[model samples]
Target: MTQPPAAGPTPPPGAGWSGADEIHDGLPAAPAEPGAGGRGLRRGLLVAGATAGVLVLGGTGYAVATYVSGGGNQPEEVLPADTLAVVKLDLDPAAGQKMAVSSLLDRFPSLTSGEDDDDLRSTLVTPLLADNEWGLTYEQDVEPWLGNRMAVAAVPDPGSEAGVAGVVVLAVTDEAAMTERLEAVPADSFAFAVRDDFVLLGEDQALVDRLAAGGSTLAEDAGYTEDVDALDGDQVAVAWADLAGLQDVVPLAEAGAGLGDQALSGRVVLGVHAEDDALEVTGLTRGTAPTTSTAATEPTGLAADLPADTVAALSVSGLGEALTTSWATLQESGIPPEFEEQIEALGLDLPADLGAVLGTDLAVAVTGDLAAPQFGARVRTDDPQRATEVIDRVAGDAELPVAVSPLDDGYVLASDPALADALAADGGLGDTEAFRAAVADPDDAGAIGFVDLGELIDEVVAQGGDDAAQAQEYAALGALGFSASTTDDGGRFVLRVTTR
Candidate 1:
């Protein structure tokens, strides 16, 4: 077969970064003051502080990853005040207690026996603890204290040798005498258990389960434990606790030299351990508080339960009755600005019907499914490429890395220098496959941004580049978007632009 053009582009791929750049240019520029990207930089330093507030919008349904990247304090409400219930990944009595995860498991009667008593974390438990929401003072505060002449905590050293991540050793001392020793260690760094009443709310459990399973010593033998109530209409809260235990409960410290007593409470758990390993249970103990629950808000005859605030934000008026209300309710309930803006931008009239009243909107969670929203929702863009990219971003933000996906409708032309720089300069980035490879292999410069050979070729030909003939051979790259960036790995593009 006559191969494609001698100076032609590579085999043509499906689509490229065609429309996104266009959309970016056409849409009103976001306020330059600050936003998700700005806030993201802040999140890196302090665990829970926010210097400023920023909002980033993507094509996802809503409430995906536009969160505080800094440790500064800002009053941005992530959830609605009237929310039925807020579920937090928890561990202790069950993998899902709503308190300090480490403490909860320690007090959990049934699963205590299976516990190594030396290790107290689950996969889900660690990440949440690392976040500012939980209020950990520093990394040392979360680390297990080993035995030393004195440790970071104020407890009676449980043993002589303590371990974490399977490394390091410390000396355990008598609680009564170690005051002098404990004084040397920074009280806050070693005082990991300082916050006993810590609590958090999130939407993932399987992830917690995975993390919990990774620990060497099982938190508890919670296989047979029965749920007091069905999870169907309940809000789970993670209970926190220490990975190890104290001498008060066991002979772990016989010649023990003290098992490092850096203890934990029930408010910082990472996952839920519901199954009761009958072998390790003790009698039931009273709990600190009652559990939380929620039920789907059935329609009250209005077309929709739209949030007033979100409605005000969108400024959609002259709308049908039921839909207006439903949308209003949703907006008030932490409806993402990106989603609201897009919906309003669609200019789609709200349908006045029973279905419309009872919001049939689709909601996606990183690790859980939102059974229903009081309003109807759909993943706006059905483009697999766009959808996958969005999902990957969400997962990554949450610290979970999903496989790469295709270029999406949003990966369009852009006049913005920041976005262009993030996309990088490989000609093959405009399409889905190249994007998948890029996101999948971020280390490789070629695989990171705006991939798709055909798209690049199209851009090159449009520009009538000196190497125009060679671009035809790269038909697989697609059309090129004029703007490009070397920002990712710190390289500058010799050329970047869209076709005429």
Candidate 2:
């Protein structure tokens, strides 16, 4: 963190700050430039605002020590049941969680650059408040009142033009100090009310007052509770959005590139957790569009059958059925007629011919040295000859530099014919220790993705630069694995990075 230049004596509380009126009208406008410290303060606030925006769309940290001893209350317990979206960060986690976080941060030195302390106040908050014109140091102002947990939520606001208002919930250790801190800041956009150990901040007094009243909270909503409960492991941070409610706040059809109504009728929840050796992020959705195909419930085995030397691979089941189902859904949703004409112009049927080419199981793999890599696509087709004929027709006079050949049960398209022959001869990717350690429940997954990092790490080390040292940190990193499967209601996915 770059230190800002020294400034004159600190201004009196709420002294030189401007833009208080903007809080009532809309978002707080940038305060009038005061000195170097003031400029730093402005930059910090902007960055914080941008992070909040991302949380509202996608969905960190702490005042640590206070909550670790006696875990803080969950933010959802206090938020309104009608809240559209929420992002919460837990600073004080369990002992194992602390280690996982530290180990993960060690992998990337830049994030911890110029920092000597691990305490959140020292390493994070202090830097943001270091040279503010208000002369407010985290130690003197924030640390005294800040607690361990914080969250931001989007709630319905009939009075707002956007039809939604933002709410911030911060855990407080000292209500009096928290009150003084708020008064010291000239901004009035944040009308606040204290309830128990937490303070609710909103655009207006009515909103915070409503939260304080707290009749039916989000914790009582069955759908929200189910999604959060589905997440495995103890979470360090969590984000959730009600897709149906979000559509009203954000234009889902345009934003999601023509998503159907069914797609926007679900709830999405994302959780971050620290494992013994790896940090994991899990996502789950419920009550979304339904697919009748059961092929995704069974493993394809195409990936495991790839050559043992494969460095990266992706395998997906039920592509054919999924394609047909999606096309039918799109038609029902009223796709532009021109889109269908474009497909016809390409000399292909809507889904029949495409489905045949993709087959039920599809896997793509990369092998050999990085300088001379080989790529192969394997498709499990009932009629290999017909699939080959379609490939030839698609290639037509283009004279593509690839070969199509038959496997025991399917067809393989390879940039190198020898690679295809190798696949037919032998495959042991499933037997590799790295693969076994990385992938989980491969036999039941709908989709699987994997990458062996050993060779890639070596290649980076050979280059021998500043990055070489950083790459070395990943030496213990064996591979990365991803798996997705359909659930009774919707779908679930997990991503894991394993270390030897």
Best by lDDT: 2
lDDT of 1 at 1: 10
**C-alpha local distance difference test of each model:** 0.23, 0.68
What candidate 2 gets wrong by more than 4 Å, as runs, is: 1-70, 99-113, 116-144, 245-257, 287-298, 328-350
Q: How far is candidate 1 from the true structure (C-alpha RMSD, Å)?
A: 27.9
Clashes by residue pair, model 2: none
The 10-residue segment of model 2 with minimum total lDDT is 53-62
Instruction: Pick out the ten consecutive residues of candidate 1 with the lowest summed lDDT.
Output: 52-61
Candidate 1 per-residue C-alpha lDDT over 1-500 given as tens digits, one digit per residue, 9 for 90 to 100 = 11111122323322321321121122212224633442222123211111110000001101111111212211111211111111222112212221222232332233334433233232222444443432332122223222211111111222323311111112211221222222333333332111111111112222212222233221122311122121212212222222133223333445354333333211112212221110111111112211111112221111112121110000011122335455556655576779657546544333333222222222111101112111111121234443444444444555652233233321221123322222222222223332232122122221112212333335445656444544443332211111111222122111111111
TM-score for all models, in order of appearance: 0.19, 0.75
